[model samples]
Target: MRCLVRERNKTRIGVTALATLAVVASGTAVVTAPEAAASFPRGEWNETAYRGQVEVIPAKDDRSDRRVLRGKVFVDRDRDSVSDPGERGLRGVMVSNGRDVVTTDARGYYELPAYDNMTVFVTQPAGYQVPVDEYNIAQFYYHHLPQGSPELRYGGIAPTGPLPEAVNFPLVESRATHTKDQNCVIAGDLQTYDKTEVEYARKGAINDLAQRHDYTGCGVLFVGDIVGDDLSLYPDVKDLTKSLNGPVRFLPGNHDLDYDARTPEHSFDTFRAQLAPAYYSYDVGRVHVVALNTVRYPCTPDVDNPDGKRPGCDDPENKPTYNGRLDERQLEWLRKDLAKVPRNKLVVIASHIGLVNYADEGSPVHQVDQVREVYDLLKGRKAVAVSGHSHSIENMKTGDLAKGWSDLFGLKGLPFPHITAGAISGDWYSGQMTEDGYPIAVGRDGGRPGVVTLEIEGNRFRERYTVTGQSDRFQTQLGLNTPTYRDWYEARQEWNANPEGPAPELGDPHVVSRDDLAGTTWLTTNFWMGSTGSRVKVSIDGGPARWATRTQQMRGEDQNVGPEWSDPHAVAQQLVHGGSVADRSMHLWRFALPEDLAVGTHRAEVTAIDSYGRRFTDALTFEVVEQR
Candidate 1:
């Protein structure tokens, strides 16, 4: 048997390196040992810093300051963000000031106590749509940053001197958002680092979105990694969103951070100025989408290293790092947000770093640090989580487990569904070019690049992944895995990456020998969007269908990982063509070939059924030979 060896350091992509450590309140230095530090990995958390003492700045009380902002939710006939005289007010619309939620009166007029740095937004009412900016990003809220940001790069919210008499929000009536059946577009990392990559995205997923009109109301919620470190590309991202059919909303990923900012309050200031609020909630049909800020900068002090080589709390302003965590403020806001939502409503939590993922299945640092706390808050509520940043597509059903989560977070199983929406810039836009002029940037799990759409009917939802430029039925890839395939997988990884001589060739993916069957041979399937409650069945030579076992059971066992768990189809492509390794996957299924089968050509028909009971079928033909 050939084993695929992966370099640990290179395995993790899109995560930033650890910068420094900080001092704790007890005057002890926080550090991480060199050996243990490697386990922490980089890229996931970057630019985080630690401090001996963190000052809790109380949110300003607008009422105490004798301030009240009035606004009218008007029906914008023109669909422009600006309110006009001909437009009529939309009564009964909900509005908020991050804490209080109120409904508009008969005249569509409402008042809220507004304070400095508070975002006052209107809850996009069912049937009425909010106006979008040039980037097609919904402009439902008006940020009030009285004094602007305190000394920061990229310039935070501009100074808005005094509270205006009114801050009106405009909306347009739309049949798309009124019905219970809605399609919400969920796209993961569009981590375009440069303009060239931006063009690549324009031609790829963005182009696909432009051609489709399904998600017009619920709109597109890009779950983090909107851009690679270059905040300047936000405008370009906005421009790309213009091609989308729905109003766009964005959650800030670690890469979207203001790295030069000194404090948590100012971490996403630049993001707020350009895109949507750092974290907020909106309603569409029966679903309440709560976009949370999970990337915490200048994470808790590490207590094992003292060379000051790592970013630390003493000089946090200069050395910053990031971690997947939810601050007290955001959690408090979440509590308030959920309070307004009905008990039976389906709560969709959106963030950049995932609550849990298979890509970093055993890494506590990559998953949300406060997962238990968040889960506890959502107790008894029907909920689902969607995130990006891991660059891989994951559909973790209720009760899924990983050793890291159980060991670090004490989480034995998932309470609800958590889906990591695959990246649009798959594998950082790596690998060979395609006829469509984009790279076949397959993910680490071997899932192809795509965007996930949640088709909702009332509180129940079904997820469907649409690979860029492909139909919805293109759900899985099938291949044969044998000793030869494994050996070729390993050899090709080194050869394709750095050509040493004539490239190694994999044998016909269809043919298998008796020796191959004797050694170890199996049929593998990469179900890009498969999740818990999903099943795969295979029928050989038109015979009775037999169930194929899911590799990672997600039933509190340690993650079933490594090359043995790799996706044979994706491994074949990535190893030879050059891209992220396709070793270890959450959605891979395998079926052992019958060793006593007659030597001849046989066809295998496979069917994959999702949690929603939707079935996708595919067929493959292979040969059972006596010998090579």
Candidate 2:
């Protein structure tokens, strides 16, 4: 960001009303506004000495009856840590104690029911910027743990003696963040298991992000599984944040849980201590993004999994498991949070486990158990749900249906767009090594590693996923599926085992025989984010374009699975290189050519149209021969 973000703005409310608070206001030290759009020489946070922390004022009176946590959300006018004269409190900013949410009053003062080990945080309101540390981590919350976390591995939060008298949150008014146009990045699953995978992420996705300057306005929200099971690597994850030029927020996934904890209440304490609140919401532009901790760890059948799908929870010998369910407190908190958001604003519900997933559509444990309730809550609102865990990219629009959704969720069609943002560490960063020091790590459904961006102007949005190491123009992967290829596909069904004889050679993917044309040969296009309303058109040798048929109709049918429906292009790589096969994608489209076409070279001009009416064109050349 070239321009300064700390410039003062004209006031709306009079100064007389600011008398209640002493010190006030803050804005970005350096941020690129849409008006003054530009990039920084370095791909790093716009950090400066203006970095600030939350103010924790010690208590004066000690009656030992502090049931409610009280604080003020003030604009740190001087960017000082303390609230002084002329600095006014910001009103209507929501604050939460990790559960119950409350908004600040006209005076920017708020009181919420607090408990032990709770984190009191202010949801950084739109048009305002929160103070960030040198590491660019947002400093908006105060952890209140009187006794600290119990002794365990990775050393949890240290002890704090008592709750503060007032925990004032300091924010700066940033025109950089105040704009109606926003390109909010909704990235999912950078689940690096160790240092190697961490390095891969740095070189792959993080490096790709550094070259772009689009997200400084609204910033980036990593939807969960920030790392694998190792809590110790949080610092390494922070190092990756250095490459970004935007404010970053995180949501916890199942792998982020503290498995050492004996109970569910403490499952994510380590994550909260190291990263962010287990669940929270913030506003940017006209969108209210709700980041949810959907993975419930140490799930018990009695409370967390009442539906009985998690039968292992009842077994004495079984290790405590995780399930896709929201605790009562979070559910209640979501209700309150959504109530405050106006009907006109777009509500983006971001989570780790998707509300509904195409990859794990039949598994009860993979999707949220309270999907119906979530849908009910989102009624009469323009909303979208984006999640990560599945590792596949799916763009399911409203009115799209699946049999598993009908059978398990009792959902015939989606209430809103439910997109499964493809992972940064695609398939756990597994596959043949790349020259740039990473893996191809193609996703299970053939989608490559990528990040999803929601470009919004006011309340509405257009979504797109950019493949890592590739430009945004690259969207679809084209391939050929023939009768002979299917035979080789079935022979290589054992994904890990090597064939006894020489593997069948698909000599030239472009070459086709009369037998191939006669026996249901198809031209496959893997449009990663394609969905019900998306279209794929093919024109043979520059002839008039014809629409291609989508493999999985998504009209209340089970998975249109196996080799025939698989992305043969991705399958060839996965079978030989590594990772899950590209069988049964929600976005695969196919077109069959006429069997009697004259034997000659042919060119297929492909055009893919997304639901938002964005058009992308690609082409492939092939040949029709008398014999193979």
Candidate 3:
């Protein structure tokens, strides 16, 4: 798959009514680097008004050169960035030496001689828009590095010595022009393990994109995990992009990696060659999009380290074992990238690894290192950082930015928002099958597999999550704890029990019986559970339920940690009272029916289950009508 580079768009120099911006073998026209010129005229800038140009005049003594090449670029009048049939190439479109100018050929292409350190940029015409990154930074057409740029201590384009002569620029004709006008789509991890799963994604996402035209105008940005470490699937992903109505951009994830990346520099060589800037900035409308590379490849192998080592970088074993962090260079580049952006413009920092304090706060593996520094960088700006890789949904509205980093660094609440965009693959390789016979990667948090859309007006943006092939109705929050749920859970537990001898008889998977409904309480009975130390609850007829203390400790099959004496999942072994059911999988929850109920046909349902082990109810039943 071809990794496309969508760059940051900065303010383009505005060229005036100059008919020709040409520089010949010099007589006396001053020739210096372009950046030495004044700021682009603010009021003169427009989407349709093409500006900025450079003259390729040779040195005074060297008059032997006769070849003069020149061309002009504008928002493709026909809207195709590439030149096409019947579309007139804009002529007389001025390019300059920051003073004098030149125009285009019949083909609408422009050129200038190779010059040293010249900042050659296109003049944005009136009523046309430029592109930007999530950080609201504009993209420069080309760095024009003839000798190549310097190596950035942090990260940036290497310094190329000079701009080459055949300097032609491309522009997609955009009409509705405003610094504030832009649209963007955010896609989380598209982790597919095999070709079948790739086809599954094709059936799900590709089918959805084929029908979407709204996003065609802006383009799509895919947050990492493009492939499940199996880089071979990238071409298939590229095939999927053809279905997209707009340009496709990508940021790398742990899965999209060079397994041989022993050091940080080699981390994304494969990805860089495929995608654009690994951690770079681009602009669209008033927003600056900063895509970051957060998966840090350890230079030192931990193969013999105390903790268990992982297999291939794509393997599931490798994920949790490795910590996610932005290397020192990326962090530095971020600081500089942000410094260039105006504070008023909205900045969207996109990364594969989210900041610390995700699902497992204490676990450094899930969080980003130096996150506090990252958060601190956006102190006063209107900014939001979005990431995916956790494969779950969490919109943490925390004023406390350093809640996860305070101990390590003296950091505090962040001034902006950090949103963890839910993964497109949902629970990685888990989920049921869809009608198309593809495994449905339904999100564990009840969110539908989809993309996020940002509507920008001025510097303000409203973010909306769009589910693939479905309407907003599919966006939901699951509620638990009705009497029906209690019975279903009990039955579900019994049904899913691992076969020690034999499995239970087949019955209605959704039904809740009176016996199971009695003492109607269901526990989450596992280790990953127990928020704030809350446990099981039992209740009947929507009344208050009492908590059930763990008597016996049960452990997961994979559990081999410290002494099982304190493991909550291990402690829940008491409820495994009878029968040879699987230990860790069986979560026993119980609730008793109300005492005052004059039994006829009473109904119960588990409507909701909270993090605190609290369960809500929605239940009803028909009594004998009192025989009046």
Best by lDDT: 2
Give, for candidate 3, the lowest lDDT window spanning 10 residues.
1-10
Among all windows of ten consecutive residues in candidate 1, which has the lowest summed lDDT? 46-55
For each candidate in turn, the TM-score is: 0.83, 0.91, 0.58
Please identify model 3 stretches exceeding 4 Å from their true place. Answer: 1-169, 176-183, 299-322, 400-414, 444-447, 477-498, 504-628
lDDT per residue for candidate 2 within 351-460, as digits (tens), equals 99999999999988889989999999999999999999999999999898888889997887998899999999998898888898999998899989989999899989
**TM-score of candidate 2 on Cα atoms, chains taken together:** 0.91
Tens-digit lDDT string for candidate 1 (105-175): 88788988777777777777777666554345666666667677777667666664455446666666767
**Which 10 consecutive positions of candidate 2 have the poorest summed lDDT?**
1-10
State the number of backbone clashes in model 1: 32
By the TM-score metric, which is better: model 1 or model 3?
Answer: 1
Better of 2 and 3 by lDDT: 2
Instruction: Give the alpha-carbon lDDT of every model.
Output: 0.75, 0.80, 0.48
Error of 3 at 47 (Å): 19
Runs off by more than 4 Å, candidate 2: 1-50, 60-65, 495-505
RMSD of each: 14.5, 6.3, 13.3
